[model samples]
Target: MRHWIWVVAAFVAITPFTVNAAGAEPVGSAGALISGKSPDGLGTWTVRYQHFDGNSPVAAVINDRIDDAANHEVQHATWNGSTRRPWTFDATGTINVRPTTVSEIFVGQYNTDEPNMPMQSLGSVVCDSRSGTVITWDNLFQDKTSGLTRLSAEVEARLAPAASSNELRDWRRSGQFAPIDVNFKHWVATPQGIELHFPPLQFGRGLKIVTVPWASMSDQITPEFVAITE
Candidate 1:
């Protein structure tokens, strides 16, 4: 539940494109719609995307719409370029909308960037339709003290195999392993557990996703989130 302020100027122009995927149906003026019965057979969900432009003509435009029929909730994600410089934008990844005992969640990943700059990883965006909650990295822990310590230890153990000996030594020497420092923000929920995402340079040459089972860190997670994982 974050609030965003968008200011669109007159110079900007928007062109709509229709998406026709194999199993997708087109919703009324919305870009595309994809729906299915939940795995448990208790509910239904839909995902839609609308094409829109930013304030500037060169800006990137992409939006996501998620509907949780069982929970009667709707969530939206919108992204556009900020700078006037030449840019490249792509939202090509899987959009997973699934239901748990008490909630429906949506997760997505994409890439975007401008010239000469490193590719930006729109790592993962997750929405909980039941509570209308948007889970960010900061919300994962109960308290910064014990919660972060355990998280850092777990993450270090998982990433150690991929790091060079020198890199590992440097990380240990710094004695700081907070999620923010390591860029541990992108994440998604799976049937088995919650998966943490780390982009290139954060760990190794390419993207990395590490799954920490719900039972392993049950103590650190908030009460509300436990149901979704179950």
Candidate 2:
């Protein structure tokens, strides 16, 4: 990770508690909305980053990681030079699952410009708001081996209905698709299901969400996971 050195000040905001759906916890704080525009002579670039709690020590862990990656892309663009001018980077965070039930699921939606197409990356975390600690991915599954296998299969199946079956077939055989790993390293848990993202051209789809519903995976998920998603 590139060590971050500040050239621009980021705007930070802490949202006060607000009403939420019945049985759900109050909507917790929103992240500091940090944005920066390149100074003169660097060419034109802008960055939008959020979902970082400037007040919490642990929040920096996730925030800095994403920031470094985003900055790397910004630097890459300046060096490589995209066909399109005014390169951009956005790393916005969302609380996919509210902090109502002792836990909250947050996902970083990162986008950066490429020569021909925009690139996407994901970072997801499930935090125990009560404990102020992150809930590791492995802890969610009962039988880790089988659960992961099932999850990987579900992800593959999600892309089956897309128009680019030929490309999908080749992708399945490629190194990126094989040896499927459901590390939960890149996922967002919603009320309806778990959404895993894949970037454009992967399946000839602009962007893809490989959603696996909570019901289908009930057998594999731990009781704690059940509670969180419920």
Candidate 3:
């Protein structure tokens, strides 16, 4: 974790929002119907995000995703008082791939006053370096159907060792590798391949990563994506 990404903040007005296709990130609790309050005032949260050095739209999108991810504590935490339970949050991301352009990914986790509800959130976004448009799985491969089919097969194979439970196996087939936008939400483009981030709570225990290598899917991957990753 870089020092810049370790900085804490609160309700900062400049935080960027997510793109339409990227979808709303899952929050800790949303302060949802869950009643709660901190005996102490809402303690300040430790929020940190990956700082992009560039000013391009790609940078903007990544920063926004990080900002949104880090706020899960303040926006969704639960307790029973005027203020939500005291929670601390931290997030980090990186420009993992820059084939024809740049792409980024971010993940966050928080510790809270509530015992049962430990917080964990993961988010990732990839954008066109020039246009700034949110890029999806369909965009990474030239032939959407074949691309996904191949990627799906490859991803499942790689995750075989980690898919220890039936729940994980089902999600791997239906959700994680599904063409659904949210399914691939937590991912990054990498020169090595498309690296996935699966938070333990949802997938299993510790974080699990399964990379679909470019060499295995080169024939169908978008040329732009293969240029740098392969």
Top candidate on lDDT is: 3
Model 1 misplacement above 4 A: 1-85, 101-118, 137-139, 173-176, 179-182
lDDT of 2 by residue, 45-75 (tens): 4433334344566555545444554454454
Q: List the residue pairs that clash in candidate 2.
A: 25-100
Number of clashing pairs per prediction, in order = 0, 1, 10
Q: Model 2, stretches more than 4 Å misplaced?
A: 1-26, 29-31, 37-87, 99-114, 175-184
Please provide, for model 1 over 11-97, each residue's C-alpha lDDT reduced to its tens digit, 9 standing for 90 to 100: 122233455687452221234344333222332233333321223221121132222221121112222332223323223323444
Residue 53 lDDT, candidate 2, scale 0-100: 43
* TM-score-better candidate, 1 vs 2: 2
Name the weakest run of 10 consecutive residues (lDDT summed) in model 2. Answer: 100-109
- Assess candidate 2 and give its TM-score to the true structure: 0.60
Which candidate number maximizes TM-score? 3
Name the regions of candidate 3 deviating beyond 4 angstroms: 1-10, 13-43, 55-84, 97-99, 143-145, 162-177, 223-228
Per-residue lDDT value at 27 in model 2? 40
Q: State the weakest 10-residue window (summed lDDT) of model 3.
A: 28-37
Name the lDDT of candidate 2. Answer: 0.51
Each model's lDDT comes to: 0.45, 0.51, 0.54
